[model samples]
Target: MNAHPLAPIPDADVDAFWRDGVICLRGLFDADWIEHMRAAVEDDLAHPGPLAREYATQAGQRFLGDIGAWAVKPGLRKYVEESPAAEIAARMLRSRKVNFLYDQLFVKEPGTAAVTPWHQDGPYWPVQGDQILSIWLALDDVTVQSSGVEYIKGSHRWGREFRPIHFGGDTEAYKMLPGETLPDIDAIRREPGSGGLEIVNWDMKAGDCLLHHSMTVHGAPGNASSTQRRRAYATRWTGDDVVYAPRNGQASITIDKPTIQPGEPIDCAVFPRLWPRPQDSSLA
Candidate 1:
């Protein structure tokens, strides 16, 4: 698989990410990468790692999720260190450098009815910065009916943080962050102007990816399709300004705690530096 984007990312796309807190870049990963990721996804499903979790929504459909794949999966480790993802993240966030935070695999099987709750990623994590973002890559053809994610345009600039809603009715899962949580976005969508907000989403092919800021408020629907599965791999990247800020009752997947102190750049053995490729060739 190629280590760089197949085509150059236009300046306009970068601008849109800053303006809207999210943007979909088409065909950045080639077919080879998709094929490789598909195999990796299947392997992960068969042999899940430490952080894997299985969820069954009210409709009794299955939703599978796992995080920190690069720690155990060879294919994902190669993708994290060698792929163009890090550079793309750096360019989009306009950061001088980037680091690999973690990888998550989300699989909503055909007919799954679990609605990923509306929340901001920043509050759930143990990090702080404007440059943190996630690249969600589709491994299968995705449509609105097949669980495409929807983002509130420019919510990241609202200068507000929302408490995370634990998936599958586990309110006690995350320690609530200070401030009011998100309003009913689904309810708001039914009204005109969607409460003066523009929610955005896209139909994506296997190689397409959506990059969104960590503070962006977003959520996904269940896989309404009866045939196609909605499988996506998300990689979270941190830019130059981000720092390690551990929180109590962090909701994100567990990792061996880093030696890096609080308020310092998260460049420990777990969250390795990626953009300025390390001198150690084995890691790069």
Candidate 2:
């Protein structure tokens, strides 16, 4: 955590994260870091990795998404290794050590009308635990109207799982198996605070980020803004409690080789540990 460019999270911010399952740390990353990441995102979009999922011309929106950019982009790898992001995860999770999960890059071009369905991230992931969290950094200034993600506060405590929604609006997955669909988005908007549900959102500038719990119910509106493009990178992290629980029939970008059991601790060349100050702790 060498002179972590990010500011140390205050007690209030930590409290907000734990209580609300989301917290925004303003300017935690410097302009240089943001620029580096933005460049990486632009370049990656231009070249495009095998994992990149882009909308076709007929989709009527320009939404491009990719996972696991660290393996393909050097700038992303540098930010993951050097930035204060891991330390932030450690302090929030209250864990002695942390692991880099993976990278998610989502870009919403102007006038994009695709809505990211409201859902919890846990049901879709192979890893399972309460200590999962993601740091979403803004590459450009964004507002709630401009496609910033919104979270239903305290939803992480609901302790229920829902079917994962594919990016292209296929509702078949949720229809196949049943848990509970995200508490009706339209109803919540109509009757706010009716059932302990308070929707929280933020207007963010470049270098600002929202750290959200993995289980938090979140989604975003279409990029309604006519001019501004919404580019965000979400880097996930895991703590001591996280484990490999690969769900049958789901492929994870984080997992590549070897056979780690369902309940084994996650560590290796993949999911690299990032906390307790690796070199300094090794010396200690």
Output the number of the lDDT-best candidate: 1
Q: Which stretches of candidate 2 lie over 4 Å from their true place?
A: 1-5, 55-60, 173-178, 192-196, 280-284
CA error at residue 258 for candidate 2, angstroms? 5.5
CA lDDT scores, all candidates in order: 0.87, 0.80
Q: Model 2 TM-score?
A: 0.91
Per-residue lDDT of 30-109 in model 1, one digit per residue for the tens?
78888998998999989998888887655568888888867989988878888789988988989998988888899999
Question: How many angstroms is residue 204 displaced in model 1 relative to the true structure, after the best TM-score fit?
Answer: 0.5
lDDT of 2 by residue, 209-268 (tens): 889999899999889999999999889999999998776545467525535677987886
Candidate 1 residue-pair clash tally: 0
**Candidate 1: where is the Cα deviation over 4 Å?**
58-60, 279-284
Model 1 clashing residue pairs (backbone): none
Per-model TM-score on C-alpha atoms: 0.96, 0.91
- Residue 180's lDDT in candidate 2: 71
